[model samples]
Target: MVKIDRRWKQVVRENSQSPLFICLGEKHEVHLFETYFKYQLREDARTNDVYLIHYQDFTDPLTYGESLLAEWAEAFKSWPQGTAAWPGVDFTVTTGTDAGRPVAALAELCRLYPHLAEQHIFVQIAPTVVSDFDALRNWISDWGRAVKKGGISKLKLVLTDHHKHQTYKKAADAVRFRIETDLTAMMQHAAEFTNPKKGDPEADYQQQILIASNQLSKGNYNLAVAALEKAVRIARRQKLPEAEVTARLMLAQCLAAEGKTAPAHSEYQLAITAAGEKNLVAAQIHMNYGSFLLSQSEQAKAKTYFSKAVDIAEQIGNDFIAMECTRLLGQLSEGILTGDAEAIRYYERCLEIAREMEPEKRRQSSMPYVAGILLKKYGEKSAAGKILDEEMRTLFGENWIDLTKKPKQMK
Candidate 1:
């Protein structure tokens, strides 16, 4: 029996030089193929000089004759010569097949200019159903030989099929790697917050939101949106009013991130209506809604929502929320909502709250924003400079004052 582990690793390493192989069995195998090459490219830092060629063209094979190789080759040739030597590397993709046409074309070009082959890497990925396995293997062998003769360092053949093929098993040993998906990790992490002993509608709702948050962090926005929507439905079904409001607000935030402003606004409006009173979660909803409106350039509407949040924060006696509300109120007052006097009032209130908080939390929470507002609006350049310097000394105890310079505005 082949020591499958050692054999797979050896093939993976050798193929790193000129890996030509087929992936057969399951729709999952295509995802695996993509993952394997992605890992290899990232590991070797060959991201710039990696190519992916799709052979089947589309779901319909009738339109499969389009070859992108000639265009890719011409474009590669037009690039500044010797770009791939020492400082640069280029990648090219090609598709379609008239048996050995692409391989032959590449071989001829490599023979004409050996350095071009050395500097560039080529990849060919064909759907396994279209061509006979024997013919494909023979072509790969011929192409591999040509690649070796031309002194090319890397070439890869990726063949994909939905069903296991006897030909692949007979000719090539299967190499596999597990790929992590955002959805899988999210579900696993959500499971952590679940407790049968403390099970309740609120706990379930929080767990769902946590899962959605994880999905968002992983850049799976669609999944996050879906999860939030489901959480809302679950909360409503269970008659958990607070959970329903929170879920709707979370959904609004997710939609805003996706730039779906109209729907997000509608959701935020629904959340505001549902919240009904001064509550921590409701205040958060108002704050997020206000921020969203500001981002959308609805400054007047944003100010109304921010003012509501500020009132709720004060009612709840939550200084953290009050501080945030004040900071945002100050930001809005600078231009969006009101005049400079209002801006200064809000800033001063925020500064007061920040000062009253524990020193560590104050440093972490509000000093940076306060310093920024002073510099930008008050034009207290020296005072802003001094405040930032002194705060860093007292809080971070580091002379990282130079790190706080404003970024250049883009035209």
Candidate 2:
């Protein structure tokens, strides 16, 4: 449903009289324009015998003309030569060929079809159809002269290439397709030309990560997973453990989100193992893993990971991890409703860390929830309730008691 470029329509229209039309620009743009051109031709009432051929599909360039003739013979079987409905024969050839191969193929076609001289033969090539500009110009000129001698009606050639050349401009009606959109399709299409074989595998890996991130943001989980998989492979090949860990972690999260728990768990373990003794990342990964397990209701396993995360956080002096892991541990403990002293201790330790943080950070502390638990478990006159109420009042304004909403099952 993407619209073709307006300038391409204008250029094609303006060159209606020209027997040769050469499109030049980026590969995707030219390819898209080729589709638009074909659509325009098919819509015309005067056209019928339209065919498209990928030149690369033929293994041998020498047999290109013979192969094409065989294909056309089949078409002729379907629609007789005298049929007005199939009068003009039009072809769109997408090739990575230089001038010589196509010129030779055209010669063979002319030799085999003597009636070609008496009919209009239109051909188009997209993006990288020819190399050696001077050779192409000479071939076109020589072909035109030879076809003219045979009383040929008109032999049209539409060649597209990546570069602009004066010889091509002089030999054919050349039009350039400019890249106008920076959307996802265009971005992905552009990525198709990135050759990791040309050295710089890291660029390809980075591109995959970027593309995966974009896909993730668009909620295309399958595509994101595919891209991250490629990124993981690339990182492994590049011998970059950090990159591998990053990709695996992202892949794990994506798989987990999609409910593919087994693969997600595998990727998470791979990431954790790859992280090794990198405490900062290890702590964060353990906490995330714990959160994932908690979501799956694996409370015992979740507690184990949260405990490891807490130990690592304390070792690394990472207050963020310490606060988060401690809070999570408290939640897991309090979920049992066993009035465990351990749960209150975890919550108190988490609040102590949060209190030292900035006010903005302190507001996100688990202390408020601890107050709620204390209020629900015991009367306001209890020692724990009085102590928490005084602190909660300072954090949650004068209506702190009202702010405490008891955990659902606690009541």
Candidate 3:
């Protein structure tokens, strides 16, 4: 098997159970289609046979699909003499010049070979083949409905275009949850909060916040921001400072995600003011703001806020916040400055905080922190490293993956 790119492997591993994947990217440069085909071949070669179909070869959509059934049937006839049983096969179809017809072909293929839907199949479509964005979007809307209507099995559709527009964004938003387990779970949880209880005046405002969370998980930042804004307005009208602060914090997150940096910063400031300096909510706001700053490449500002948060958390005896802040600081020290002394101190404090917390509140992955410290203080071949590796293997089995290593790419 060949090595696969880290991002590609992460996607595949996380979505192993998902029936579909929609990857939208640049047409000429990204090479998302080719990379995905190679990655899937390497990842699933042991269990399933992989085939690629260039859909442009056939003029008619029905004929394009018929060829696959014919090929699949022929494979069973000329089996190797020593084979134990009939082998299963998966397919990847790519459409270039004839992108308009491939969707029909795919839907027909699914109708004929409903059994093959159980295996992972990939498809690549060239968006430029369409006349305009409207055409492309119409194609996508139709295609999405067909898939949801139980037309395809395991399909990964890669859209290669020179540039992405609103159509691409909408398509990605529609499918992101299927590709990410955490998001799918979050969406499910959010659905429970969608309806307010009868005669509960506060439930409406609370519902907005919960629904906003669902939109955020779906990557619909604009919708999330709008929901949070409505929640904040309701909270302010009710004179509920705590609820307002919570709403504002979420509003800031959505703003930041949408790349509205100035508005995000203002929202964070408003939230902090509302929570007050010594409050636990203030500490949380500081931590969240620090994370935002870190994402924006403001390390010094992030460090200052992290320090403030840790100080407040220590005063309030909130071990969870302290543990989290210290861990973040440790990551920064180790990753950015490579400052072993500071990083080790922060990590040790984090571990101490974790140990002191109640079992239910404690995070179970402290061994990785110790392993990280060992890797920094001593080389991979050192006694500490050997001990850490052996311990990790004992805990997670012999094939445990190393957290520090980058996934290999195909040469």
Candidate 4:
């Protein structure tokens, strides 16, 4: 089970809140639910009464997929809605992992009984349970519509995803949700006025920004550029300097990934100026700008930005970002950038920091990163090799990091 992040723990302890946990795979997901309940009790001894539907009751899978939802909804309508004993009983609905069937059924139930909106908390534990083959995409879209159209109540949806996984409890959460929260309020004014104020372009701009980021993460640079370019236009037109800076930064990242040095550099400068040195986004801007410079073989310039990022990351106590930047710095130090003794010293220092991370995190990220950089630098008849070769092989097995072979890719 994943550690209880404070954001999630807040959600779990929320009295009268409902969580839909998703569990799927070849075996049982005892951990997710067990952890959920354990944390719930630990956070609040008097956790709200939860009306849980494990949904082992449904066995039929409509070969067509659509019929399953309809049928399940019909069967589930009879279950007790929160005990009418409490006038304002908070109700939660949860489905861990295998959310396709549960989602389909829940959507139907919610649509049939509008009263549930007042008390319903729909929890999606591990939303990845709904995959492409499950035809769950349409179900998810319909569910979102239900929540948005006021058919499911005016309350905002509670959503979290690995991609859109956000801790909305943060200060930054306000900007994104603010536009959405105020739209209905804006509608009231529109009704009284002869003309509706132009639609809030930030709404669409935010969406485009999200799309662009997703595309970039998935290695779809061209599509990311397209979406980000559109977002940039909307941001500038709407006088959203922050949005413009964010879009330009993302666009620069895409451009750099595509190996377009000159334009990427230009965008980085414009975005850096817009974000200023002290903005929270400065760390990201510097880190990414460093990567862009490194990609263009501007190793020295890259090193400076990386160092700046390290400083901000340290100030902010973002060890993850600090480690990643340090890793990149280590790469540059030894890999054709400047194989000086100072670089060698930095590599050893960075490795020490990596080793200090939590065991799982260190193994999954830093260990591989440090091993790759060292092997690339010292693995080939190199002075660094003769000194650290035995130690490096011990850290990463010979099979995993082969020093004798030419490096397959630049970091």
- The candidate scoring highest on lDDT is 2
TM-score of 4: 0.41
* Alpha-carbon lDDT, every model: 0.61, 0.64, 0.61, 0.54
TM-score, per-candidate, Cα-based: 0.46, 0.49, 0.45, 0.41
Mind giving the per-residue lDDT tens digits that candidate 4 earns over 1-411?
A: 233334344443452222222222111223333345445434354434223322222222222223433443454455466322212212232322223333444444455555554444434322323334233333333344434443333222233322243322231111121101122233344443634445658666766776776566568888889989998899889887788888998788678779886888899998877777655677878887887777677899998999998888778766667777876776677645444556656666666766677766665555555655565556656776655556556655665454333223323
Report the lDDT of model 3 for residue 351: 57
- Give the Cα error of residue 225 in candidate 4, in Å: 6.7
lDDT of 2 by residue, 1-411 (tens): 135536644654665444455666555556666676566445452443343443423233334444445555555565434343322333333332222333444545555565654444565543234445454465455444444444333555656655444336566333444433334555655566765255477877877887887788668999999999999999988898888888998898899889999999899899888777637888878887887887788999989988998888889888877877887787788756666677878877877887777887666555576667656555688887787788778878878666455333210
- Two-way lDDT contest, 2 vs 4, winner: 2
Error of 3 at 375 (Å): 4.7
How do these models rank on TM-score, best leading?
2, 1, 3, 4
Model 3 alpha-carbon drift over 4 Å, by segment:
1-200, 214-223, 277-279, 334-339, 358-367, 378-411
Better of 1 and 3 by lDDT: 1
Question: 299, model 4: CA deviation in Å?
Answer: 1.7
RMSD in Å for model 3: 15.9
Worst 10-residue lDDT window for candidate 4 reads 172-181
lDDT of 1: 0.61
lDDT of 4 at 344: 56
- Least well predicted 10-residue stretch by lDDT in candidate 2: 93-102
